[model samples]
Target: VLDPNSFTGQEFMMWTVAVYGDGWLNFWKELKPAIKTVAPGWSEGWVKFTTNEAPLMVGYATSDLYFDEKSSDKSFIPSEGGYIYIEGASIVAKKEIKDGAKLFIDYILEEKFQRLMAEKNYMLPVTDIKLGDEYNRVPTSTKLVKVKTKDLEKIEEYKKELIKLLKK
Candidate 1:
């Protein structure tokens, strides 16, 4: 399980409201028994899922391209839509080459490179581009869930409760 303080886990804990409302405690209680193993390393979990050692793990739908193009393993966007995890890039400060880094960033934002992200990386490009048939086949949702301010207030509580359930 991911630490609730993490970006992914923070978003996931917020999603509990959409799925279970105030019953999140009970939800975790029920799920705890179903967890066969907990490998904190992300790749370790991915390896298990790809090898059929595990049936499920929380991950992006676009991840399917990593395992197999036509494999039965597919991801679905929840009906309530799914949380979008944003990514960002920045040049490390101590390493100079500021101009080169700027050029690299500019290049990555170009449509050509964005297409490469969709086709090869299996990530939905930040820019609008016609995805290939295979990439287009990846599931998408029109609606997206936004975490409310009230949920933000409960992040620490979520961490504690989730930890307790997992431990118990």
Candidate 2:
């Protein structure tokens, strides 16, 4: 997911800011050396971490309920304002979306579906919905990063800069 050349690269789009918070690029230079491995994807990282191959890895704070493992692994919310990565829905203005797709999007946004997604998929619902009691055990941070919309336009530039920084 960190591959800068890939169309779906998410390091610039989400991971950097969400995982590290503000000024993440600055801290990355110092932290990269200590990082033993950068898993190709989330599943690989989580597996390595869970199996004790990796001490720490990027993962969902709600993973404890999902895996039900006892360990020293702690979900950390970066004090500098860690951004919660929440995927959103949007229709491309250039593409013509049929009624079926529109209905599907609307359906997913509903509280009932949202609650189901939270329960089964382990994702945060867009709207407030009562989740499982185990959700209460997950760590939450009041200090959340609010990404600037203007910075979104600079993603490609940030990608190049991040790739360069990673190479160093």
Candidate 3:
């Protein structure tokens, strides 16, 4: 288990701010009491969660897809909102193999590729690929929260504040 006073929590707070925007610090403060044991990272946390050492642990909603037997675990999308970490494929500037990179990107965006990724990687499809029944069990909120690119400019400052707050 990670020490609650450790920098891990502070780093998580920083990530929360980067993805969920402002007010995460206040939420963390409020929720701290309920958080009994903290793990050094997600892998450790996942072990704790699976072994029932922790009643609640942070992870992807689609995590159930990786399990052999579908767990009763449910993902709750808070009425306030939830954060989505978006992943993208980008072609680096001045790349030697630009055509290959473009082809890869195009292939990735295809429905078949998206479906395969959603199934194998246990992640949400970026394209309009049909999802499996497992995905239906994951609760989705209409009010998903996102940090604007403009707000991202202050991420470093937010990290500093998060560290200070966690240290307190």
Collision pairs in model 1: none
| Candidate 3 lDDT, 3-107, residue by residue in tens | 333344333454466555567668767766687676877678878888899997766667666565556776575565666656788987773766888899999
Greater-TM-score candidate between 2 and 3: 2
Worst 10 residues of 1 by lDDT: 1-10
Model 1 TM:
0.76
Superposed model 3: Cα runs more than 4 Å off: 1-23, 67-70, 93-97, 148-150, 164-168
Q: Can you give the TM-score per candidate against the true fold?
A: 0.76, 0.75, 0.72
Candidate number with greatest lDDT: 1
The C-alpha stretches of model 1 lying farther than 4 A from their native spots are 1-7, 89-105
TM-score (C-alpha, index-matched) for candidate 3: 0.72
Candidate 2: worst-modelled 10 consecutive residues by lDDT: 1-10
Q: Rate the local accuracy (lDDT) of all candidates.
A: 0.73, 0.67, 0.67
Instruction: Give one digit per residue, the lDDT tens place, for model 2 in 36-152.
Output: 665666777677777878777656667666666465566776665555666777766756678877898899989989988888888878887888887876788888666567666
**Candidate 3 clashing pairs, residues 3+ apart or interchain:** none
